[model samples]
Target chain A: MGVNIKNLSILIAAVALAGAWVGQGQADNEVVFPMPTGPLYVKECGSCHTAYAPGLLPARSWQKMMNELDNHFGEDASLDEPDRLAILRMLTDHAADNPNANMLMRRVAASIPRGAAPQRITETQLFRFQHDEVPAHIWKRAKIGSKANCGACHTRANEGRYPEREVRIPR
Target chain B: MMRLLALLFVMTTPAWATTPQQILDSLVQEARQTQSGFTASVSRGEQFYRAKQTGGKEADSCASCHTDNPKAEGRHIKTHKAIEALAPSANKQRFTDPAQVEKWFRRNCREVLGRVCTPQEKADFTAYVLSVK
Candidate 1:
């Protein structure tokens, strides 16, 4: 009975050690902003432009964008009713204003005024502050057509990771 | 067991999988139903493709983003996103899916012409793209 007890204790210790190791690994690999996953969101929205992280905007902004899809940025991007609602749910659930949003996303949400619902992420104060160093002429480059083309400079924008080290302005 | 396996295989296969020719034929049929003697015209399609539209933000045409040559790769006029060639000869996946074909047609026609395209226009446009070698 003593031998069985000792073996059980050893197994418990091993399991505890394994759990700690896994927790440490997760902490080490945690990204600043994890990518949202939705096949319809990528297939429909990503087809035209970068499928921006929903954490970039508040829930109100996403609502407005989804409602005005017919005249989206001077282009017709209207989706079927089901697709529109599904994407809206996905966007609002992960928006910066969402309770489960990360620290940075909360900061982004706090930066905007209470009443204002900015349509473009490029128009946001945080965006301007982040891109203050970039010259105006850089945005006009043929390779980087406009501010909306995040993937032009951010190599892994599609993957939803935008580390400063990954940026490569095209000539 | 063999019959069960065959049933499972058939269930797993997509019923919507179709060829570009099949989609084009259906669009042509719809056009004929709308107009008694409707026939797809490649030259008319080319003219429609190249015409400069006035209603939208800019004087953008189908050629604005798709370019004059359907076989060559094009870029999104604003976003600069690289678009695949429209011609079936250059890109085998051009008109394979009915849903994708309809979605793009609905969006692009409205963006360029300020309205959805008729079945006749869709048929002629498909014929023009399919004709390109």
Candidate 2:
């Protein structure tokens, strides 16, 4: 019976160790943000531009963006009240400032000043800092028209994974 | 026999599924209710699609994003996103849903004309796109 208990303890220790290792692996892969679900969010927002990962902005920024959909940037992206609210919930639930946000998303939220809600993710300090090395003319490339086009270089932008090795700048 | 009939109905008409012709016909019907003797014109739709408007942004028109050729794939002027061809011949999924049809008309018309498109304008635009090969 004592030998069986010892073996059981060893098995439990191995499982705990494996769990910790997996948790560490997840933390290291912080580039992957949570992708928003629902057909409405994808179709309505993605039709015009990239449906950016919700973790790219804070909850407040998303709230501001949702509120001003009638004059979104320079275009009208108005949605029905229910749809707008649904998309808003999806965005805020996974926004950078969300309590359950991952490390990378936490950094995104931390970079922005308190009470400052920026509509454009490209205009964020972290985004600019990350792409600081990229020349101004690179954004004007025919294949990479604007900074808003994250998938132009980050091929896995759609999957919410922006790994450095996966980036491929178009000529 | 009833089960067979139900299956046949489902196979022929999926829920919320629509065709370009059906969508255009419905738009025409709506326009007629608003304006008696209303008739959708392919030529008028072509003109509307090609005409530059001054109400919204400078040089904005349906052609600005959809391109002059509805059969050709277009790119978003600002985001550079690839918009599939608008013509039914080139893209089978152009006007398949009534809701999707209304959504784009509401958005593009406001962007280019700075106002919601009238039922007549929507019908004309559909007629013009359907005429494209």
Number of residue pairs clashing in candidate 1, backbone atoms closer than 3 angstroms, sequence gap of 3 or more or interchain: 0
Query: Evaluated with DockQ, which candidate comes out highest?
Result: 2
Query: What Cα-based lDDT does every candidate model obtain?
Result: 0.85, 0.88
- Give the per-residue lDDT of model 2 (tens digit) for A8-61: 999899999999999977855758888887577778778778878999999999
Tell me the lDDT of candidate 2: 0.88
What is the per-residue lDDT of model 2 for residues B1-133, given as tens digits with 9 covering 90 to 100?
A: 9999998997988644788889999999999999999999999999999998988763389899889999998888888877789999998878887877888888788888888899999999899999988
| CAPRI category for model 2 | medium
For residues B47-108, write the lDDT of model 1, one tens digit per residue: 88888887755537888988999999887888887677999899887788788899999888
User: Candidate 1 i-RMS (Å)?
Assistant: 1.0
Native A-B interface contacts kept, per candidate: 0.70, 0.67
TM-score per candidate for chain A alone? 0.81, 0.88
